[model samples]
Structure formats: C-alpha cells, structure tokens
Target: MPKLNLSQSPAVRAKWEENLKLDSQEKVTSSQQQLPNSAALTPQCIEKRWQVIAERTNKAALLDTDSEKQQNLYSSNIEHFIGTVKLPVGLAGPLLVNGAHAKGEYLVPLATTEAALVASYSRGAKLITEAGGVTALVINEGVTRTPVFEFANVTKAGEFVAWAVTEYEQFKQLAHSTTRYGKLKDININVEGNRVYLVFEYLTGDASGQNMVTFATNTIYQYIIQSCPVDIHSCYLDGNLSGDKKPNSHTMRSVRGKKVVADITIPAALIEKRLHTQVAKMVEFGQMTTTGSLLSGGIGVNAHYANALAALYIACGQDPACVAESSIGITRMEQNAQGDLYASVTLPNLMVGTVGGGTHLPSQKACLDILGLYGSGNARALAEVTAGLCLAGELSIVGAFCAGHFSRAHQRLARR
Candidate 1:
C-alpha cells in the first residue's frame, strides 16, 4: 500500500467516499422483509421466526443467507429452547455483533442509544468515501478462566498442563457423566501468584453451561489431587475461590496471567488513522462497575445503544458479567483500490447466557419472549449484538470525523 496523497483530485476523493458508504440497503432493497424501521409491532409479526435470535430479544428477526437455502439454518445436532421473558420498555436495533459461535445475520437489542449506531457510523462510512473503509488490528482478545484451588500448594503448574494435554483421554475416562457435559474440550491450567487458574473448555452439549462447567470442575477436583502430587487441603474448603469466579471474596474481580486472544481483521483502507484512534477511545470508556476498571478501549467503544442491547442480554438470561471482555475488539475497514482504508469492529467479551442469571427477570423475560430466543445455547445470538455494536462505533466515529458534522448528531442526541 503506497502512501499516495489523496487531496489533489475531487473525482478520486468522491470514488473513495462512495466506497466508504456503509449501506445495509438489504432492508431497503428487498421487498418481502421490509417493514418500517419504526413500524408498530403486530400480532402476526409477534409470532417468532428464525433459528437464531437478535440480541435485542424484542426484535426477533433473522437473515440467513442460508435462511434462503434448504438445509437447516438451525443445526440438527443443536436444539432450540426458550426460558421466556417480558419487556417493560421498547428495544430497537440493527445492533451488529459477531462471535466465533455465531455464523449468520440477525438483529440484536440495542442496549444503548448506540443500538442503531450503525446509522451514525454509516454516515461516517459515507464521508470516508474518498478513503474507502477502515482497518482493525487485534491488539488484544481472550476469555477469562478463573482460579483453581488445591488443599496443599502444588508448585508444578506445568505438570498439570502437560498432564491435561497428554493424558486427555485418561481425564475423559475419569468423568462419571460425560452425560451432563458433552462440550468439555481443553483444560488450561495456569499458575500465577501462589494460585492456579484452571480454564476448562467444553463443547457443552446444549445451553449456556456456566453451572454445568462449575459442576464438572468441582467433580473433577478430587481426581486431580488424588492422582497428581499437588496438595489439596486449603483449596478444598474455599470453593468459588477455586474455579472461574474469584480468588478470594476479598480480592473481588481482578484478572492476572493466562489468557487466550481471539481476533478479527478489518481493512485499514477506508477509515485510515481514525480507525486506530477511535477504538483506542472505546477501551478508555465502557465501564465495568464490578471490576472498577473501564473496559479497555482497544476493541470497541461505549455506546448508549450497545448498553441497551446489553440490557436485553442481562434481561434475556446471558452472563451479564462477561460483557467486560466480550465487548472489546478491533474494527477494521479498508479500500481495495487506493490507500484509503476500510473498517469493521471486533467485540470479544460479550458473554451472555440463554439460561442463567436474570433471564427470568419479568421485563427481561418478556423481551426474550418477544424474540423467542430464551434459554440455553443462545450465547451466539447475544454475541452478534456486541459485534454489531463495535461496527456501529466504527461507522459512527469515522463518518462523523470525516464529514465534519460528527459533533452535530452527538450534540442533538446528547442535548436532551
């Protein structure tokens, strides 16, 4: 990519500007699914459709490129279940979020004013037309696996890791019920600061398996100590201090050492340096009251809309705790023809459960009830909301920065 100055020609800038347009004209283009963005909900529309759900459960529509195809969009191996919820307020969106587990297009609840933020970002997307798109680099991403306890302090964290990896089958054999958890995949054990954190990955057969993972780990604790040289007396008594929860209730929420980074790539051709600068801002905001630290700015930005979408996540039964890590990631967009960059946003820590926490919360449950996306294994759907939000952040920031009217929209939105 040569650094050619784009200031000389109006034609070139216009071409790039057009490329920067972040138009989701699909709703505008297609005839069948078209409904007013603000149309009142109908009883006929009330009947839930699609295999996966929008993050904002109130808007339960889905768009599967595969939905147009024959083979099941909802996998045969996977099952659909709902715990159901009710919403006290209206949830609106075009909240965009993407996740490893989520594959297609769907709407999500906009937890904040940023819910429809793509519109604002798209405005930026259009201005950078001379530039083309934005870019993204995953400076960081990874999920948290909490502490493991042992009665006696066993020094060899390596030994446990090696054994877990090498003796995988043996550990698999020790389990009394693969029945409860078919999803258990890898066991990662890390020793940091007089404590070891065990992160066990599983292909949980069905549902958001937080409790299932805890139960399985607890069941396996005895086997680890009895077979390995690690001591077990002190760890046995303090339970939550053991698994992915907390070290000691005293320490509260803090993360140290042993992490996994997941990332997505976005083109830099469209949004240019604005892409990098904006994401850095996101990390600066996005507060986590539980941790007393704002979500790092790298991954995405703080959005009123994203907040609203998260509300649906909390209300609908997702792990409200995970939004900290899951919501941050890179937004990349770039231009194919010129040096002008492109953009897309990445969100990493949007952990939502279709089954636990406040999913049963009345307004929350009804909201999920509207989407028919409640209960177990709906994490994928919720993740999409977070991803969509990051994208909205990118579009909003870039479009606003480029067009010179960015502050106007924000001023109006914030005034009331």
Candidate 2:
C-alpha cells in the first residue's frame, strides 16, 4: 500500500488547513471556559457551576437545577457538585422472599432507562410470589483487600508470609480500631515468586466496605512497614487479587462481597400460564445458554444478571461500579421429579449495603425505604433481596427466550 499525500492537492491542503484552524479555535474557546473551583456544597456554588455549564454548553435545558435541595446532604457523596441526573425508576415485585434475613413480600424499586426490564423482573417476581416466594440465603459475607509486599527472593517472601501469620490478631485489632461496622475476618497469603499478596477479608456490616477495608488495610500496611523485621522491596495497597469492581474468575469461585443464593420451584402449570412456556423448554434453554456461556470463557453463566443488579444498585444507592462483579453468577434451571421448574441463582459477589455510600441520598434512601431495608441490620437482607431479584430476572429472560418472545417483547416495549 502507498501512502497518499493530501498536501500535494491544493483543494485538500486548503480544506485540511481550515479544519486545523477551526479545531485550534475550538480548543482555545474550550480552554477559556471555566466553572467554579470551590468544592462547597452550598447552593450558591452549585448555581454558579450550573450557570457556567449553561453558558458553555447552551444545551443545559435538559439538566434541571430546580430539583436542587438539601445540597449539604450530598456533600460526602459528591465533589464539584452539580444538579442530579434523574433516571426513571420503576417498581417491580411483591417479590416474596423466604430468606434467613430477608423475609415476606417486598416491592423492589428498579431505577433504569431500559424499557421492559421492570416488567420482565416483575413478571418473574409475580410467578415466584405465587409459588410461595423465592428462598434466598446469605451463604457468606466478606469483603477483601489484597496488599502486595515484594521481597528480594522466594525465601524472603516465604519468611514474610510466615511472620505475617503470627500478627493476625494485631492486624484484626488495628482494622477494628478504624471502623465500628467492619471486622477483619481472615488473612490468606498468596506467594508469587518474590511477591507476597496479603488477602485481608472482612465482614462489613450494613455497608459496602470498599473504603472501609481500604482504610483499615492501609493502617495495617503502614504498621507492618514500620514494625516488620522483614525487609520489603516494594508494596501496594491492592494487588488485584480481591477482584474489586471487576468481573473475574476469582470472584466467581470465591466471595468478594456478599455471597447470596436464591431459588424457586415454579410448578409446571405456573410456568405454562405465567411464562408462556413449558418447564422442559426452559430447562433446555438454560442448558444451551450455560454451554454457550462456558464456551465463551465467561466468568459466570447467566442470561442477564447485570440487568436487574444495575437497576437495583442504582435505586438502592449502592456503588453502581460494583455491578461488574456483583452480576457474575450462575443461573440454573432444571425440571424436578414433579415436573416443576427448579431454578436457582448463586451470586458470589453481590456487593451491596443498606447503609453508607449513596444509600443515604434522598432518592436512594427512599428506594431502600420502599424495601424496608434502609439502615443497619439490613445488609444481609439486602443481599438476599438482591439475589431474589436476580433470580427473577433470570427466570424472566429464560422464559422469554424459550417462548420465542425475547425480541418481540423488546420490539414492543423498547422499539416503540
């Protein structure tokens, strides 16, 4: 292939120079535009920022500032405050959950822009509710922070690991000193040649403990650096072993946050009536999809766990980014001896909380309030509910696929 020189042509060269000049002018104009630098949560600062945005974009008509109130309440959650972006929140359920912590029928609030999503989840919820609700269980709960310590050789790494094992009590005490809700559960040492990765697991009660564990681990890291007899060549707060905020095979096998499982037995008649499909067909669809998922080298096998999880996370004020890991789960559908549809979803990384993060924000709090899971003593319940929600999503999507209504439903609901 030969490279063409557009500069040789007068028309092309003139057009290129004009385009460059326009790009330069636009960059200069953009550089000159400035918003308020103050991080104050005051309405005055917010208004000034909005004014700058309006002047610069001339397209701020859609961004409403009229809804701005209680700006200080958002101080902890946001910086360089501006008005909120409103998403259409829909209600799904009468999702009856029969879990250890989360029990009874609850209305699930789903904040999303996707059409038919709430309806699909609600359809599954209704089926589950009629079938005596879903049985959800908090199998385990733990958040992790993996701090890597590098040494000169494998001998030094092994020695550091040996010494670190004795200091578990001290590390636990140091971690506890930082947060009332977070508890250091266990520490597993992973050695890779000359590096030692300290995987610190914690039970974070009622709040998603990313920042909590990070702070506690940093404290322990500093203490180790100062007091450890072993010489460390290098150190990092996170060694990516914990799989925070990313979908990986590690989180699929082990828990990164709360591990929750939800299952429901839908009668053959109920499956036919509600889902417009037979139990055998649903099972067959599940088998094919599971095989396809495995063939694709995916972390977890599921139809669309992210759909329900993203909506729930947004509505509940949980970190939306955690949905990456939280959505990785296994959805199984099999016909029981009684010919009923036995469906289960095991979510190993359902990173959620009923306190902290965006949970206290007005709309988020309101959503959590709707589920009656707005504060402490409700994190486990929240996780259970999340699993149930995902189960509902799985059933609905699978039913749609089996019934040959997936694209038709989307066309009717979304393509309009």
Candidate 3:
C-alpha cells in the first residue's frame, strides 16, 4: 500500500508541469538513474501517463504509444494461457549481493553494470564440487492446487479468493494480516477437463510472488477440500500436468515451474567461424558489466539499468537463474547486393517483470504501473518486452558498428 498526500491533486499536477518545463532545457538526463523498478498503473492509467510524458517530451516520435509498448511484448496465443494453477511458494534470497551471500566471503559489485552475479554463483558452485565441476540433478516438484472459482464457491477453495470477491472493505478487513494474497492480484477462472481451476494471479507486492502465491493457495486449497460442498472426488492440483504428485484443488502442491524460451541467430558464418570470437567478445562485454563487479559503472548509459530490469526477473520471479540463457547476443556481417557489409543482432530471452519483487519500491512500481504492464498477464508480457528492448538495443549497437546514425532518430524526436 502506497500513501499519497493527494490532498492537492492540482498542486501535484502543477509541479509535474513545472518539472517538464525545467527538463526541456537540459539534456534529458539518462533515465537509468531516474526511473524506479516498477509502477501500479492499470492499462488505462498507463496510457494517460504516457500521454503526459509525450507532452513533456514535446515529440510525437518519442511518445510511448501503447501499441509500441504492446508490440514489444510477447506471449503464447490466448488459448494456451486461458487456464492456470497454483503451487507452494518458496523463498531464496537475503541474497547478500553486495558482499558474501551470508556474512564472510568476497566483496561484490552489485547495483553496477559490471556486476558479476553469475560469476559469483559459479565460484560458489566450484567450491561445492571436488572434481572442479558439479552435477545438477532432477528434483521433485508439484502444483499446489487446481481449482477455478466463479462468483460462487469462494469459501470452499480457501479464504483468499473467498474474501476478495466480497465487498472491498470486507476484503480489506480480511486482508488485514494477509501475509500475501490479493492486494496486487486478481482471479480469473476458466474450466477445463473434470477440474475447476483457480488462476491465482497475485502481485506478490515485492520479493517475487513465490512465497505469497504458495501459502495463499495452499491455505485456500486445504479449506476447499475440507469445507466445500461439491463432489471433489479426486481433485488434482497439477492444473494441466499429472501423476503420483497430483494435488487436489484448493490444497497445497507445486508445479514444475513455467517454461521460458529464448532464441537468437548469428549468421552461420558467425557461428561456424571467426564470429564466435565476436560472440565471445560480446559475452565478455556483458560479464564485464553484469551485476557483480566494480566496473558496474562506466559501462555506459542505459546498459546497467537495462540489465537490471532483465536480471531482476530471473532473480525474483521463476527463471531459476538462467543467466546463461540470457547471457546471449548475436552479430551478423553480410554483403549487400551493391556490396556494403550489412550487419544485425538479436537477443530473445531477457526476462523482466513490471510488478513483482522490488518493483513496488516507490519509484519502481510507479514505473511499472505507469506502463500498465504489471502483475501476472503483464509479467509474462514484460519478459518479452524487455527482451525486445534488449534486442533492439543490440541491433542499435550493431547498426552503429555498420550503418551508422543510431541517435539520429532520438535527435529527430528531440527537435520535435
């Protein structure tokens, strides 16, 4: 819950206008330092904010059109995402990013472009292995519950859903001590198979909804099986998958985690030969500036913030820390018909969440909310958008290495 002294909306609006007037004269400072981790705006509010930002920018080209924002986002077709399930929440932080993860170790270059998060993790992995390398094994997993709720049967599933559908104040009262539930979430249920599923969309507030979703769903599931009036028969919690680990709706269980895919292309020549060096060089560039080194700074503008926006997704949400999958970039060199070298780059994973974890930090949430890309639906979409932004950035860099004039568009917008 954010507190706003909107005792004076008009005054606040005036200051915003004044700030724009002042910013117009200066080089628009790089937003890396200014923007927060997230925001709380709904899609509609996000649009309005961008309209205001457009006015401030005084440029049609730079205006953040909603479609452009949406264009950067990706997701499975609506049908695949039409259903969902819940799983027990888990916590894995207190991540001592700036130093030793727990007290006595090495100093870290966190909060910098050159941070070495993966490198540090690798060192930690090395210490655990005797033969200089460690092997990872498959661990068991389960889905917490798979019950869908409509306007009715709220109580049967668990208290969280039961209360949210009621009046707002009643919900507020019930949520008073809610460790995590519906403040930053919503429920949309669609039935499939013999199961009634609950699409548990929660805004874990901050700290990634991991703990919040697990407990809330687990508590609710237990209540449903024990108290609900319907014939549950043998309810299964895997939502869409199954076996001995199946869980009944409204009870605690777990899922094998969401599937995240990333793709990249470097010309065959690049992949088969010399350009591997280029790719390695770029990877070196990423590592040199990632979140675990002192060189986190001086990595140039926007790069650190861009990586932060992406890395935060894996760290807080469900990526299982695929720093390597995301540790990708592409480079291309080709001959145009007229004979000039044409080159390009693409990065496809780069996950980012607009609403979960520290996204709600005063400024962060404001950033997410302003974009209207918060919460679950948006979380999935944001991962795609962040990837697109990075891909675009990568392309922009490659273009500069070849075609030239990367900032021309920005300058054109500034003139507008």
Candidate 4:
C-alpha cells in the first residue's frame, strides 16, 4: 500500500514533510517536543481539520449529515472528535419475545459487514416466531466494581473483612449516598494472601453502571479508610475482580447486567422440517459442542453468542468492548418427553442499558427505537430481547452445522 498524506493546507503540508525528512527516532523525539496544532485541537477545530483532509482525499462530499451528527454527539463524550467511520447497517427480525419486560414483535437493527450474519439471525427469528416466540426472563440485575486493598498480613485483612461484614449496612448507606440511581446490592470479599478484594455490586437503573458503580464504590472506600481498624499497605480502585471486559468464571457464575435467559420449545416435526435436522441430532450436536467447550476450558459454552451480541451492541449504541465478557454464556438444547427440542440460552453477564452511553446518538437511538428500547424502564426488556436474539442465532448456526449446509449458506450469502 502507498502512503496517502491528507494533511491540511500547503503550509501545514510543508511542515509535515519537513518533519518527515528526519530519521524515525529523531522525528519521534522532535514531535514529542511540539505537537501538531497544539493550541487549536479543540473538538470543533479537529472536525474542521478532518474536513480539510477529507477534501484533500477527494472524499469531502462523503462528510455529510452523518459526520455532523456524530461529531456533535461525540463532543460531550470525547475529548477529540476526528470523524466517523460508517458501518453498513442491516435489519433482522420481527423477533417475537414473550419476555417479562420485552413483549411483542421486534425488528433488530444490526450493524455489520459480515454478509451472512443478518440472514442467519433472521432465519432463526423466523423459526422462533413460527414456534410462538422465545420466552425470556431477567433473573438478576447488578453491575460490580471491585477495589483491592493490601494489608501488612493476612490476619489484618481478615480482620478488615470481618469489620466490613459487621458494618455492612453503614457501607451500603455510604455507597447509596453517592448516586441517585445506583443502589448498592451487596459486597463480596475475597482474600488472597495479604490482599483483600471488595467486590461491590450495585443496581444501576436504566444505564450500564460502570461509572455509577465506580462513583458509589469510591464512597464506600472513603468510609473504610476513615473508619477501618487495619493499616493499609497499598490500595487501588480496580483489582480485576469485577471481571470488567474480561471473560472469566467469576462473571459467568454471577451477574453483570441482567442475568437473562431466553428459550423455546420446538416440536420434533418442526425441527426436522425447518432446520433440516432431527431433534436427536440437534441435542447430540449441542452435547458435542458443550463437551468441546469444556475440553477447551471455556468460560461459557455456546455457539456464536458474540455474533448476536456485537451486532446488537453496535446497532444499539452500547460499549462494544463489553462484548468480551457480556457474550460469555451457555446455549443448551435437550430432547423433551414429547419428542420436542427444548432450546435455551442463558447470558449471565449481559451488560446493556436502554439509556445513557451511545444510546442517545442519532443512528444508535434510531436502532434502539426499532426495538422500542429507547429511554428508561426498558433495560430488562432490552436484555430479554438480546437473549432471544442470541438463542435465535445459536439455533441458526447449530442447525446449519448439523444439516451440513453451514458452508453452503456462507458461500451463497457471504461470497457475493
């Protein structure tokens, strides 16, 4: 590939070229001394410069309404707003969900470039809807932020944990006092050597509560510092115990956002007719996959949960990075007494929100609105819908694999 210099005006280009003449090491040292446009890198100024670069590349006209919308939305959330890269958005659904909060048919907006993904999920949705929709429930809801403290000895740490346990109500009050919408649910203590990790879990209303839990946990930390009997050797806000953005057994066993499960019962005849596979074959494949996952020491055993979660995250304006842990879960199918296949997906750490984060952006809001998941009182509804989508995706992939047409579908849709 050739280098494309889409720098600003002639004067700026001249400066950039002059700097480029130096050796790599010297250029790095010199650039550190003086940044490019040090005083004029405001959000608005940055966007203006990006416009110039776009023009130089003969793509200035591509910077249309989307550029303006994204730039404006990013101003409040980011320090520097350069530009927006467009991801092709596709629609999949009329995914029917008989969920506690989410009910009725929903059109799932998916943002992806993968050719066959939307089709596969839509096929699953069709089967689910035909079978009278997926049943979904939000079993639990909490977002955790852990803080670790190191004491001089294990004894001191134990003592501190005991103290924390005794005064749990006081700490809960302190944590709750920090935020209007965040409520402290519980605090779990883990002691490793002389260090103690306090896993503070909170119910963050209608929002992914990373910031909310952080703010509340800090208040509890302050209370401990002032009132605790033990002397702390070292302390930090996060100790990786919260399982944030990382897949681990800790998060899979506990709750992150809403521990939601979605399931459906498919008659054996329908399974064979629609999926092109018998109920016994589907159950066998599920067991095989589960065993394979277990042999690989996987945290969650499932087929392509991340596929559905990532598409939904991008379309709904969520923290895309959370898909790391959020996608970890189990997909199960069994042959019932009535010769039907009972399929279910349980996502333990499905961290999502109907408000805050990127949900307010124009395109993201539009996608959320497609599922009627915009604004408050719909976080659980969103979780249920997400779980249902995951189940649908699982069925499509597993069915395709079992039917020996996985590659055929991909070659037909993706190769084009």
- Point out where model 2 deviates above 4 Å: 1-30, 56-66
Worst 10 residues of 2 by lDDT: 58-67
Candidate 3: deviation at residue 295, Å? 40
Candidate 1 wrong stretches, greater than 4 Å = 1-91, 94-107, 112-170, 173-182, 191-197, 225-230, 236-309, 338-341, 360-362, 369-372, 375-378, 404-407
Residues 239-268 of candidate 4 have per-residue lDDT tens digits of 988889888787667788889988999888
Better of 2 and 4 by TM-score: 2
Taking all chains together, each candidate's TM-score versus the true structure is: 0.49, 0.91, 0.28, 0.88
lDDT by residue (71-167, candidate 1, tens digit) is 2322322223222322334343433223344433334443333433434544432333323222222222222223365433344555555565666
Question: Under the 3 Å rule for N, CA and C atoms, how many clashes does model 3 have?
Answer: 47
- The true-structure Cα RMSD of candidate 2 reads 4.4
**Most lDDT-accurate candidate:** 2
In model 4, the clashing pairs are none
Clashes per model (N, Cα, C within 3 A) = 107, 0, 47, 0
- Between candidates 2 and 3, name the one with more favorable TM-score: 2
RMSD of 4: 7.5
Q: Write the per-residue lDDT of candidate 3 for residues 173-239, one digit (tens) a residue.
A: 3332456333423444544444456554443332334444455555555565565555455554335
